[model samples]
Target: MNGDWLLRGRDGRLSVYQSSGDAVLCRVERAPGGPWDEPRKVGGEQRLLPVLAVGQGADRYAHLVAWRPTVQGEAGLVHSTHFRARLAALDWNPVGHPNKKGDRTGTPAVAVDAEGRAHVFVRNKGGGVSMLAQKEKGGWEPWQDIRGKGVQDGLAAVTGESGRVELYAAVPEGLLYWRQEEPGARPVLKESLKAPVRPGTLYALATSPASTTLYYTGTGGELWAWRPGGEPVALLPSAGHGPVAAVRCELDGHDCTLLAQRSASGRVAFAAYPTELESAGAWWTESGPQLTVDARVSLGTDEDGRVVAATLSPSTGTLLLTRRKDEPGLALEAWRAV
Candidate 1:
């Protein structure tokens, strides 16, 4: 299963924490397209899947929410823990417990708004959404049970320009989207599209308050995108079998959405979707470099305007970083720390 394995730290460094045997191993890079440090054991004797969120302004620390699964006799329980640490610190101090029932459905999703308040969403044992927010001084508030049914595995969230936070999840019938206009506002159920989207990964792109794009994997392994008032568009057929990782980035002087996924054959591939969806022939026809091995691929932009794509080669147990070289258009240069 895929944990929230890749994270871009507050100080432009990239960190990847994955399950190595019975422990969680973490490795950090100096910056985007830079050298990486040695991998160190971080957590012990737990199947830990970590998701990260950074605090804003003066409270600048990396906040991590990880799910720890345990099996006792016939009942399986997943416990959730929150950890916070500075960018340069080696120790991850525990902050609070978000999951009280010790049963979680998927990876937790976090988004900090303009006022530095963090909103965390997780699928509870009742197959509904349970949410919590951060207080002004510190610590988290009590869990608020948002009413929903048949909520799927993955949860994706994005805060728009108007401080409107949106959440997306998959159901058996289609996709369910919820929106909270401001902090302390109730998350209203916006829409439920009756399409055959798989119940795993959902991506929400809030480029502006007026425009937003939602992408997900269809039942047939096709990459599909949906806008506010339009029909679902099949961007790429047979895109992949997993969740799509995307980032809104500037490419060649245009705002584009960069999506990366592992192909069916276990190779890392990426595509670009231009902002002008109605433009003529604007789809990404150019091919991305096909990496030989792939475990779980991720794409993100660093602080120094550099786009870094990483994939874990399961065979060699190497986390490969590919820095985009834009001298003669788009190209990739591989880097690995000794």
Candidate 2:
């Protein structure tokens, strides 16, 4: 019912979206740390769990998809709709078919490649994996079934440095990974990356254009991350079983991956993965628990990928900007590895 995701537009502006009953509310900013505009409602009451992606220049647009459950002829069914917002217009325009329905297997996920094409991933009613892609001119391709089996876990998408668009999902057994190497590229499924099955959701952080890290909660409120080249490692000694949110941006003059998750005590905890200048690995920092539980977390960055602002969710918290001068307090602090 509140905003849960943050994104930067091609025009160097930041936008936040949250569900408000049947409609989605959007708040925009000229830049990450500046004053935010008043929230505007978009789409209809049936629109829920909206996913977004931003494209380039004239191609700059916010692609959104949502699902609403309804009863038709005594059969309960979930229907989905897709929309796109032209950043310059600040309004959402319906695109694609309005009658799309899902098997309700999982929430939809979207990612835009460097070329400005939108790639959508969703699980169907029969547990089948499917993808719908946007065409170069301006239309969506028919849904292509990637796999026949459906999954109940949530889905996420990212565009890697190789320009390949990758999708990740959490299945009962382990984390599933798939990639579409290029536009029109077939979906290639990888072996399930093994992990313990306690904490509920999986969150992905693209530490760099080419690197991504997956984080999830473990038994006993521990936070763990699937490192790029290593096995899963414990991140926080005590984290909530709730979902995690993260972003890749610049921090303290370095490109870093910032992470947010709930602590065992229900307050949000912040962490950072500072890139190692000389090596392939990185240094991660764990901070003390503070802030609202399950707060919507987002990071904003400059062209070079330096993080300029971090907006913790609920639409009422402070915009943690890069310190103009050395600041006090750990919540707004950025740390470097010793």
Candidate 3:
């Protein structure tokens, strides 16, 4: 998948997961330095689609989910989480196959609540939403239907700043939202939000303890940010054509929001602005070697909580990594291939 290729373990080591052909390959960071272990096959063979990995809660267990074709009109969703410990890629667990024919099942998106339960949500065949949650006893509940018609295929989910799981689906009109009344509770659908969000470009990040921001590319190619109670703020001097990899970190002594996207020119474009201040402004700078526009960009923190971002070049099959330098601003060390 052109999403979430990087995962940070509890010990702050990172693993980069990618599907090379039908197998899932993983490369682990041996230590904090630039040296990395070679990529090894982690997942078995299947007619797989895009892969997604979500790390959540204090344990920060990363749950990897992938969809693969089975029989006619039937498909399977599989999951894998911490095996032995963090940075270990082991076995795959089944989430059952759904056999809804004709209108094929949509792609899967996943998030974990404060207690570290995986809640898998997808667009059902009828154009509405359905969800499955991981039980405390380590099994999945039967898929439950959450009503929201005309939902587009790509869905964005996040464990919100409040520790409640929230989901967003884009319809033709605007955004359909679902949020839990409390942590570990089922997310209830809220009234539709009005925006011209482009599909496959919607992602949410908790930029602060009190604020979670929604970022997306607009129908007119502009980038927009919206919070729960504010207008959709268009980012100035936008230059990307896809979703963004975002993080909140202290740049020197000031809090900043860092964003990275694959610019239209096929390079990793990045910038950082003061957190929650769009009008204050930031500019886009392209970095690294030229990669495809759909190349996945990911962000996480090192053992010391310094920011790190990475991307893989399909053309050369090399993992390109960068890190936040110990400077007064959001400066980065040179991009290196591993």
Candidate 4:
């Protein structure tokens, strides 16, 4: 995949590594010189979803919760906060200390709104899920319980054009969604999916810009999508394990969906979906060639809706990124060969 890759912080600054196998391609750093004032080491045993939020201007910030082994016994918790050069100048800060009762074994995911406020979600060891949100006026809010006795597998949060923040969590019971109209207001549960049962894995979620349509790949190797006032539809039934990476944007003035996945043979693959289709029966045209990378691939998108693919190089063990383009169809654009 062709995308920009930069060392997140100054050298030797402990950072969170989001890698493909052994290759650490993208590093997430906490904001330095803020309330913390020190570089926080972020890795030990728990995987971290380094949540990043970019403002309307050039400012950006990232927050992640990680666990470190206790000095004398088991594990301790810490939240790593990093502010981009632009966001640091804006004085965006990490809210409060890490939640002591948070799950020290699993990765914690977070979401940020347009105002630079953050909403953190994690699954605790006791099978309880909690949410920690930051308000615009500053200071940390108390942890709120969302569900009990189930895992919060993944979270996808988006701020709508109306300035409302919506959070969707993939829990064992089903897909749970919540929304908040303003700060200090409790998030109202909006919807839930109970059919076509899903297994407990981190499923990827994405939303269309023009509508409230949500898309995700279930644990059962099926591609599922749902929108407000619509029934859930299975898009691709045979698409296999791991969450599908998707990006939504307007193409030719019509909303489009770009999804990528790994084949059973470990090759990378991609498919495009048109918004006009109402059923999952539409055909998906393949775009890229079988990848040669050794590590599993993870994908994301830029603000402009370009697909960014990251994978670890098997030969040199370095992270590689490439962008996908289409002349009339999907094509591989520039690439950073590792």
Top-lDDT candidate index: 3
Question: lDDT score, residue 109, model 3?
Answer: 80
Clashes of 2: 12
- Tens-digit lDDT track of model 2 for 1-338: 11135555655666655555555666776454456676667554444433333222224455555554443421111222223322323334433222254224455666666666767676765666778777778766677777734354566566666556776666665567777755557667854666654523666655565666666665455566774445677765534556666665555566656666555564445666564221333333344335465354444454344444343444353333331123322234442111
State TM-scores per candidate. 0.79, 0.73, 0.92, 0.68
Runs in model 3 deviating more than 4 A are 43-47, 50-55, 83-90, 97-104
* lDDT (Cα atoms) of all candidates against the true structure: 0.61, 0.53, 0.75, 0.49
State candidate 4's TM-score. Answer: 0.68
Q: Model 1, stretches more than 4 Å misplaced?
A: 1-7, 19-24, 41-61, 69-102, 276-294, 313-316, 334-338
Quote the lDDT for 264 in model 3: 78
Tens digits of lDDT, candidate 1, 1-40: 3333556655666677554554456687755446777776
Worst 10-residue lDDT window for candidate 3 reads 96-105
Would you give me the overall lDDT of model 4?
0.49
How many clashes does the backbone of model 1 have?
A: 0
TM-score of 3: 0.92
lDDT of 3 by residue, 1-338 (tens): 53366767666677777766666777877765546888876644545655544445556676777776667756677777754122456467667644343324777788888777888888887788888898877788787888899999778888776777888788988888788887667788976888887887887887767667888888888888887766779885457766888887888778888899888787888888999998987889888777865577888787787889998765467788999888776678988888
Mind giving the per-residue lDDT tens digits that candidate 4 earns over 1-338? 11112222332221223333311223432342112122222323333233222111112445444344443444443444445422222222333323453225344555566666666665566665666777668766777776545655455555555445566666666777677756446567767777544543233333544445556666666777776456778777535464555555455556666666556555556666676364535444443345543444555554345555655444554544565563444566754543
Q: Measured by TM-score, how close is model 1 to the native structure? A: 0.79
Error of 4 at 23 (Å): 13
**Which pairs clash in the backbone of model 1?**
none
